[model samples]
Target: MSESDPHQSGRGRVTAPARPSGKGGGKGVGEMIAIYDTTLRDGSQSESVQFSVEDKLRIARRLDLLGVDYIEGGWPGANPKDEAFFARAKDLKLERSRLVAFGSTRRAKVKAEDDTVLNALLAAGTGVITIFGKSWPLHVTRALGIAPAENLELIFDSIRHLKARTDQVFFDAEHFFDGFKADPDYAVKALMAARDGGADGLILCDTNGGSLPGEIAAIMRQIALPDVRLGIHCHNDGGLAVANTLAAVECGATQVQGTINGLGERCGNADLTTVVANLLLKMGRHARLGVEGLPRLTGVSRFVDEMCNRSPQKNQPFVGASAFAHKAGVHVAAILKDPVTYEHIDPEQVGNERRILVSEQAGRSNLVHKFREMGILDVDPNDPRLQDLLNELKELEFRGYQFDAAEASFELRVRKALGQLPEYFLEQGFRVIDNRMVRDDGAWIMGAEATVKLVVGGQPVHFVGEGNGPVDALYTVLRRALEWHYPAINTVTLVDYKVRILPQALGGRSGTGSMVRVLIEWRDEERSWGTVGVSEHIIAASYAAIMDALIFKLYKDGATPAV
Candidate 1:
């Protein structure tokens, strides 16, 4: 079948089937709930996550603007930075969000008034106070070296005393799950003590983060209470933080606490992104948290990742890089017809765009998707000529060219493969040499020699230049050569460069064909783009990638290539 046939027919070529009718769950839309972000306090517990005083205030304001219900700044009295944060936060006009100061209960023998820790909490000037007390008998008797009855007194005195200073008080039963397993009666009594002391909510903390979802549900069912709001704060040591939170909710918890992107100590905290997405779309309910701001979720996630200098997990449920990416021919075809077939939720809802990956596993649907993104629709799906193009893509991907990682280069290649790319300068030959010298002043001077011959608009240009490195020298020579021949050709810059070595599994063997991946970036007044080059030799790979990027930029600017 010729590729032009489908285009000529103007009928359905590929698309998804109609969604099943009458399958919608009733009234699962527009729910109002609070987003309590602890990225400052709890998130800092992540290995090596220490925010400066400025960082803490900046993050707190951002979270406030993002409309989170509460911001857990930090343990007020624990450190100087946290103390400074509390003092600074006092004057900020953070409307619609409350600042919750976190700390543990007072010592076993001290009056809450005289307790330095409780005093610090009051001085923080926060309306809400969250205090954790030892709930597990083992912790009370062994860790704190106090009798279980005395530990109960500590829980009561702390909450009751804090209640006098703050209108809202929450009791965190630390290690509530494990404590329940050890002594169910004592665990229930611990929560009861907090309630009796006028606490607003009983937060059952899975402090060790080792409990399973099924176990969480069973225990929650056992501790079902009718008096106050039941909350769940789960850690991710077992990699089930979200799962346990959901299980707790299903078993009857009113409030859920999690850090955005699951940023907490040990493995991490439950991810509110995943939990809210699942609850809204999968569970078919107005997620306890509203989904109206879903579009801002990705940007918010990125903002925090950047602040923490941590990369977002690529496969993170709704906000990950690969969340809406489609690859395999069948999958791409399905998605093209109907995105809902494979996608659980529309990416636009989460401020993420869908991507069609082109590789060995790709189909012509990938080509169509790419073309569409570039504003070229109505592609011929059954063109026989395009079959060879798909085959070429497969061959290149097999040779270690990954379009998924190097999208800029892939776009240029796609145009070239389709005979739509314009040529600028035809390089006849190029050579580069590198040299270094140690100066008498204890400094090293590195240099490069580059020679290039190129034809631009039927005129021949030869140029030689020196630079700090061989790649730079070659680039200087090429730019000089092009500029000498065609003054209209724009200058290019290498904003970023990356090199990767492909390792073979045969006894840690190294080969002459060690793969190198190079990414070159460029910018103009309007926009910027990154292109990739892959080859066995590092220099050659960089040159190949850089040339492709320059050529593509020229073509995009309506400059014709020199033959």
Candidate 2:
């Protein structure tokens, strides 16, 4: 907050490096820089990271929609899935990002014409090709078992051959910084070889991810010249990929390469999602392409995390769970008066919503803010009921129930305990049974059947259904029970669900008074929302949360439609 520079070229003295021609040239001195992402290639290289062919296609389309300049798919010959992805991506009606296929340069003795990998890359049919060659002498002599002179020939000849097939060829100088440090002459030769070989751009890589930001900037400044466009590819082994990438941009790198959610081998690659957002909104870079719906950043981030089966980092800058989270009494009080006081950027700007964490440290101002978000603007902070709510939060906090991550359930609990929640539906009774079987073919199957009776609008409904889990079976019966009347009910989905057990101390009866907290997230085509429920019985808590989610969806969609 201390510094202010409205110009978009970049913040402070850091400027966008010169880029390869035809990939959108570097903007004016204060113009915003463009971003390129490689989540599909480098990101998926993380051990155990696998994207279904469809998953790869969907993400590539989304990134293109977000206006990224290029999407690096993968090393075609290294994996069957990647090869299939390259083939499938060829047909996408992409308007923004040009699909890029990645691979290493031709082998030591293989001619460009006979190199199997190079031929596979060309057959992938992408207009852009990025091939890496050993820039570090250690890698060339030790890893490749090839002499320095031959490695240079490999670099030059590989680029030369690929150039004839595609005009957009990039040479990724793998381990360029370390290579420059160890043998600056050979490193410079590597870049020079790629340049003469018709490479469209030369990308510097901190392959081992050990270089510091200042070292990266200084080295980049030393090697960058007018003839060759400069780019950067960083890894997060040192937890400084993003910082180093930004510094390289400042020193004169034109293109920035990173992955979504910092996902890659070991620690990860620079998170392109965070990089692009910070560059545009905080650093004042102009997006050359159309990303007017920047709010979708959060949604896309969550969607990718879901597909990867990784929990979203709570404090990941911008899109993490705690990016805009507010706690501490003073901070909450200040934020309630004006969010700008505590929040650096509006969460809504990136498709994220602000969250006021209700905890033991919260004050009446925090309660007022949370109440306002719940659309209860009339709640009096000075009222005794408000004090009671604060006490309840403290009590719950002591019992291991965090409302900050379960806001929906917390809101409903507050209203119900305060006698403010309406009785739109009530459960009469329910029963459940589960079964499992092993087939002769060595396959196993598990199933659950549930029966539930409920009353809505003074009308009783009975339903029964089977499912793969007890919770799922219960949800099915509940939906069937209400489907006839609440016809708009199918629009709801439980995006996220959680369960937590509250601890207690009672010598031998500790579990007697324990609490279970359940959170359910729902989404319609327009927006996403969450609700929670808490009770002693886990199933009861889950059902209560599910009911809250269902009812909330109906209320928002206006089953009546005229309201």
Q: Whose lDDT is greatest here?
A: 2
Candidate 2 global CA lDDT score = 0.78
lDDT of 1 at 37: 71
Screening candidate 1 with a backbone cut-off below 3 angstroms (N, C-alpha, C), the clashing residue pairs are 2-382, 3-382, 3-383, 3-384, 15-337, 16-337, 423-561, 424-561
- Ten-residue stretch with the least lDDT total in model 1: 19-28
TM-score of each: 0.87, 0.79
Candidate 2 Cα RMSD after full superposition onto the native fold (Å): 8.2
Candidate 1, residues 178-276, lDDT tens digits: the string is: 998998777877876777678888888999999999998777756534446677899999999999988876655656788888999988999877876
Q: Candidate 1 — which residues are off by over 4 angstroms?
A: 1-33, 284-289, 443-449, 466-468, 480-495, 503-513, 521-524, 560-563
